[model samples]
Target: MATRQTLIEFIGERYPEIFALALDHMQITGLAVLLAILLGVPVGIWITRNKKLARYIIGTANIFQTLPSLALFGLVIPFMGVGLKPAVFVLFLYALLPIIKNTYIGIESIDPAAIEAGRGMGMKNHEILFLVEIPLALPVIMGGIRISTVINIGTATIASLIGAGGLGDFIFKGISMYNNNYLLAGAIPTALLALGVDGLLGLFEYKITPKGLKLARS
Candidate 1:
């Protein structure tokens, strides 16, 4: 279509800006993801040790999920100021639940018999937790990352509202100008980014799965 060519030309003309936008999205998403992992991994380990706390941990994350993204973003602005910092913080907060919950569930769901076998072989608790349990849990944990990344991509569109500048810039610009083309530019790229990242993570998950486990699944 003529519209498609025009859009491509527009993007090519602004390729650097588009690349920057993508990088900004990646930075915001990656920062959030990294922080979530730091927080989630430890909490997941702690939950394994204190079964009673698992409910509370998951319950707290669920509470965050219930709040609207806009509302959560608004709440953080007062303490964190505005723009990319606050936006990244919001994304990080949003990611925490999935990563933490999946991390805990993945480790917990791992076969107890395998864990016993490790212990029976005289492996220390830390050794078993890191060596045996984590390997088995990698797939599930990566699933959480996939989820969080997709969510971040969609949510990053709102980043421009706070001056964080991303693909959302196109969507928001289109809105102001009432230009359908601009909105499509933003929406399409963000959607593609989400899908692309999801596929990559899915591949990573498959690769990390143990060879023996692959047969078991089959």
Candidate 2:
């Protein structure tokens, strides 16, 4: 269709800008992911050791998770306003449920024998977690990261409405102008960008995973 052709033409003409926008979006996404990991992982580990805390922690995250992203954005806007900072903050919050929950579930699921062995070897709690449990549970944890990333890619689309500027810029423009070509132009590139990043991160996950702990093909 002519829409597809025009999309290609427009992207070709501004590939660098589009690519830069993608990189920026990813940077924010990465920031959110990293912040979530730092905050979530330790809490996950902590809560896994305490059932009451786990329930409370999971419940808090569930409440945050249930709020629709756009609604969350709208709610935050009065205080935070439209900008990259608010967008990044919201993405960070959205990322916590899967990342924290998976980390807890994964680590909690490690083989008891292995944990006992780790303790018998004079491994401290932290040592066992870092050396034994994390490696063993990495695949599951990575799956959470993968899911969060892909979801964030889509969620980041809403950042456009907040004027945070990603490929959503194109889509928003297209919508405002009632131009189908503009919509297709933005949508195609955003989809491709998300897919490309997802594949790359998936590869990263596999490559970083410990050999013996590599996930089995299902």
Candidate 3:
């Protein structure tokens, strides 16, 4: 049984390695979310313009979301054979649904009058979408991104199963070694990472939202 001092000592000795794994975890999560946003947001926009395509694409994203994260990683292992590539790919898929769904909802929920006003000003479809619609919808879109990113941080911990090392490496090691301290070392940092990232994104969400909308809602 590891005592308090023992746990502290373990963490102290392993600090460098733990920090590296944490960085790896963040890198993987960040890259996966970035990729999902790049791909998912555009798809969401494209589909919203076509009901049939929206149904199919959003349905597919929903299906991907339904799968277990580990199971998805397992499925990818054969093709990518473990490490950052497969882990990022699986996380990217997991991150896509929220972003895609939110983007669709955000754009669709825009006031018709606002859209018409843009049109009345002689704005083209693409111009109105870029200048007017997207600005109004940014908060909702950012909210979805926040949700996806927080989820990815937690899920990235499991990437160690495929040797895609992260804080989960400490967790699995502790589990295998039956050392509570090891588990704490991994679990605590992972929790902190999730909370920190979520808070930062929340701030971004607030900042991006139009102040006029905030006042109107208030």
Q: In order, what is each prediction's RMSD in angstroms?
A: 1.4, 1.8, 1.7
Candidate 2: where are CA atoms >4 Å away? 215-218
lDDT of each residue in 1-218, candidate 3, tens digit only: 45888988989999999899999999999999999999989987887888688888888989988999889999988899999999999999999999999999999999999999999999999999998888888988998899999999999988999989999999998899998888999998999999999999988777778888777767
Using alpha carbons, what is the TM-score of model 1?
A: 0.94
lDDT of 2 by residue, 90-202 (tens): 99899888888888999889889999999999999999989998888887888787777778877887898897888777777889999876677677777887798789988
What lDDT score is found at residue 193 in candidate 3?
96
Clashes of 1: 0
How does residue 58 of candidate 1 score in lDDT? 86
* Candidate 1 lDDT over residue span 147-171, tens digit each: 9889988998887888888888989
> Highest lDDT among the candidates is held by which one?
3
Candidate 3 residue-wise lDDT at 153: 91
Q: How do all models score by TM-score?
A: 0.94, 0.92, 0.94
In candidate 3, position 24 carries an lDDT of 96
Q: Under the 3 Å rule for N, CA and C atoms, how many clashes does model 2 have?
A: 0
